[model samples]
Each structure stands twice: as structure tokens, then as C-alpha cells.
Target: MRLLQQPWPLKLIWLVLLGEACAALLNREWIVGAVALTTFGLTLLPLYVGRVSGVHIPSGFLVAIAVFLMATLFLGEIRNFYERFWWWDIVLHIGSAVAFGLAGVVLMLILVRGERLTAAPITVAFFAFCFAVTVGVFWEIIEFTADQTLGTNTQRSGLMDTMWDLIVDCLGALVGAAAGWIYLQGEQGWVLTGTLREFVRRNGRLFSPR
Candidate 1:
């Protein structure tokens, strides 16, 4: 009952992925099955990490990430959304970069012992932007490698696709960094600040001064 009441959206997404995995395996589509199963596991990662690290991750954040993964791994890759919709790849790249940028902010806070009061917002934002860009570069590399080895068309128009992805990634990272900057400026009322504030609140011992 408690599980049904909380994070039901995530649970529903997980179930759908699981069903896809099972159906794919039954149809002898090994690769599709593997991808669906992997996505299902990825959805569980946040809960697993939170449990292991004693962190309290917001359910909304978890659901958002799960939905993103389902869109990318299952719908985009498996359902040929990238081929059907010209904008699908671009949207996913932006979404991923923004997520990575926000994650980078959280990492910076952890590094600074959550001392946002003393830490420089610009420095944090810069790190987040860099971190997101770096991740985007790595993803492009992976796409290149997969196209070369697995004969996948993930890169689509090759150079042009990669360039556009990087450009959008930078744009998304900038947005995320700007949000982080506002969050660090004590704008607790901001929508994005809510999750970060909750994280800090739940892990006060980890963030509090020594």
C-alpha cells in the first residue's frame, strides 16, 4: 500500500520496462531484451544508491530520471523514435546534459561539505557546466564507437549530428548552471531548489559543519 501510494509513477514505468524486456526475450530479440532489462536496472539505481549511501532522494526526481531513461533507451532506441522524429535525439541530449549539470552541482556541494554559504556560486556553476560538457563528449565518443563496432546509426549524420548534440548540450548545461547559481544564492523558492534543499535537509549530518 505504501509503495503503491508513493512513487507509483516510477513503479509503473518500471513495470512497463520489465514487460518489454520479457516480451522481447520471448520473441528472441536478445538485444532489445538486454536493453530493456538494462533500463529497468538503471531505474533501480537511484533507490539502490540512496539506500547504500544513506541519502534521501526525492521521489519526483527519481520518477523524472526514470521517464527520461525510458524515453531514451526504450522508446528512442528500440521504437525508432530517433528515426521517426528528427528532434528526438536533440531533445534527449539536452535533457541528459541538464541532468548531468544538476548532478555536478550536487557533487560540488558534497565536495564542499554543503557549505553553499561560503562557496562561490560562479565556481560551482563553472564546474557543473564543464562536468556536463565532458559527459556529452564521452557520450558522443560512445556513439562513435558503437557505430563503428555494432553498425548502429546512433550518430545519424555523423559529424553534423555530433556537433549539434554538443551545441545543445552546452546550451542545456548553461541553463542548469544558471539554475544552480540561483539556488546557491539562497533562492529557496525556486522550483529546482526544492529537491536540493530537501537533500540538504535530510542529510544535515553530512552537510552540517564539523
Candidate 2:
């Protein structure tokens, strides 16, 4: 309820959900409706967790995540962006890697604040990079399993496709990890980190022990 009062996520939430509903009703694609509802529920998980734990996540970040889901699930999976656009898969892989990398940094920061872990810039960056890449690899595995068992062509070009995806995921994670390292070190003139700092400020309690 409180989340819906926010501007960005609120608007997008209604738009996407409504769009999905319309598609489902008009096109008789019950799967689209189910996926849309499920996506919305999953999208709310972070905010729900943050609220319960006294954490504050920036609206922009949440919105960005929602948009990513929109692109990945609705546009890519439902609309067949992967088939219609040659570069769609590549773009999504890079975006997911970066998102996951940033998420790793956030989790590491929280752990450090909670005294559950020690913080070192390079080591943290490496962890973030590894975390993102590991997730990407797992996704590839899922694709493989789905293709083999469910007769889906998610792998597209077999080993070649998987390798290229992993490569892109690695590259994107590297960039995100570097950014996270620089941001934590308080390097000046960095825009993304600046936004992160602002996020921390707005949600200081989230980064500090209760």
C-alpha cells in the first residue's frame, strides 16, 4: 500500500500489470496473466523485506529493477524480443549482470554493517564480480535444463550461445565490480556511485545496525 503511493514504481506497476491483464484477457493467454501477477509479487519482495527490516531502498533503484523485469519477462519472454531482435539477448545479459553485481555490493555492505563480514575494496569487488558471474552461469544452466527437458530453444545456438553469454556477463560484472569498488572508496566525480551514496543517505538505517 505504501509502496503504491510512490510515483515511479506505482505508475509502472499499474501499467505493466494492466497491460498484462489486457493481453491475457483479450488474447486468452492465461500464462501471461499468471506471469505478470507473479512478476509483480516478486518485484515487491525487496520492498517488503526492506520495510520489515527497517531498510530504505531508493525509489529509482526499485523502479530500475521493475523495468528490468519488464524488459526480461514481458518484453523478452512474452513478446519474443529474443527472437525479434538479434541483440536483445546480449543487452539483457549485460543488464542482468550489472544489476546482480550492484546487488552483490549492496548485500556485502549490509553484511559489513551487521558485523557479519569484513570490508576490503578490491576483495569486495572481486566477490561482487564472482557473485554476478556465478548467477549468470546458473541462469545458463537453467536454460540448458529447460531446453533439454521442456523442449525449449532457450540456448539458441547450443554451446556457442552459452559461451558468448557468459563472456558478456563476465564483462558486465567486471565493470559493475569496478564501479562498486570506486564508489565504496569515495572517489569523486562518479555519477552512479553518487546515486548510491544518496541511496545510503536516504536509507542510513538499512546500512547501520539496528
Candidate 3:
């Protein structure tokens, strides 16, 4: 069936989360069960968004997001990977910044109604970089709030950790912006370009001139 042929990576992750939730519930670990169940629900977000907004995200993009969620929510937080691995936090921050930067480009394209030729590449890239940095700042704010209010040590080294995260966020955003700029200049062979092109192709009505 067509449904069976959909991306399996996300499905596998959902199944894992479901099983984890069930096991936690059986063991009477309410908090763990709730977290696992919540994560499983979150993995369905792409499908929900598509149904409501009619914006068909590529399966690959959905898989990427699902993997990120699994890493952060299921593995990083639940499995204590953040405490076990020193570099995990850094890698996640950079990866999230880059992902957000690319998302900014896509949002801008939607705002411009896909009139790529009308927008300056530099302007689009700048917006992408700013969007990514802004999201990173917000994330740091959340971490700080959690550490203060919830008594959680998410900030770890406090100011030092926050500063390093912001630094890497900017670096990642810069890379994303450069990639977007290159793609907008009509270059090919880049992964981001292919994804963007696929988005535009699938949502032709969104990009078509009014």
C-alpha cells in the first residue's frame, strides 16, 4: 500500500517511543511514561501540519525532524545522554541552528510567494542567519528559565555554556546562509538545494505567481 511505503525511519522511532511508554507505564514510572507518550505524539506533528495547512513537507524533511526529536527528547533527556556525553550538547545546538536557518529560507520563500528572482540572494541569506540566531537565543532563554525555575542544571557551566552555544549557533547559521545563497544563485549538487527545490516543486501552487 502507498501508506506502507512512506518513510520508515520516523515510523520506527514512533514504534520505539510507543514501546518505551508502554514499558514505563507497566513499571508505574508515570513521569517517564508521560514523557515517552508525549514524544510519540510530537512525532506526528508533520502529518498534522500537512493535513491542516496543506503544505506537504517532504518525507526526508519529516525524517530529519523526527530524528532530531528522538535525539533530544528520547535519548538526550530521557536517556541522560546530555550528562554522559560532553559533546552531545554542542553538536545538537549547531545542528538545530543549521536546521532553523534553512527553515527560515523556506519561510521567506513562502512570504515572497516563491518569487525567488525578485528577492536578492543576500537579503534572503541575511534573514535566514538572523532567524537562526534568534531561535538559538530563545532556546538559551528557555534553558536559563528551566535552570532557575525548575532547579534543573540545563545550563551546566552557566554563562560559559550559554556563550559557547550562541557562538556555535552563529557559526552554523553562517554555513546555512552560505548554502542558501549559493542555491539561490542557481548552483546545484548541494543537499539543501535539492530539498528546497523539491519543496517548491511539490507546492507549485504556493510558488506560482498570483
Model 1 Cα lDDT, one tens digit per residue, 117-153: 5668998899999999999999999999999999988
67-98: candidate 3 lDDT, tens digit per residue? 88888888899899889998898888888888
lDDT of each: 0.85, 0.81, 0.85
lDDT of 1 at 21: 91
Clashing pairs in 2: none
lDDT of 3 at 210: 68
After superposition, candidate 2 runs with Cα above 4 Å error = 114-118, 203-210
Would you list the rank order by TM-score, best first?
3, 1, 2
Model 3: C-alpha RMSD to truth? Answer: 2.1
Order by lDDT, highest first = 1, 3, 2
Clashes of each: 0, 0, 0
Best by TM-score: 3
The residue pairs in collision within model 1 are: none
lDDT of 2 by residue, 56-169 (tens): 777767777777777778778878888899999898889889878877877778778867566788877988899999999999999999999999999999999999999999
Candidate 2 vs 3: which has more lDDT: 3
On the 0 to 100 scale, the lDDT of residue 97 in model 1 is 87
For model 3 the local lDDT of residue 9 reads 88
Model 3 stretches astray by more than 4 angstroms: 1-5, 114-117
The residue pairs in collision within model 3 are none
**Model 1: what TM-score?**
0.88
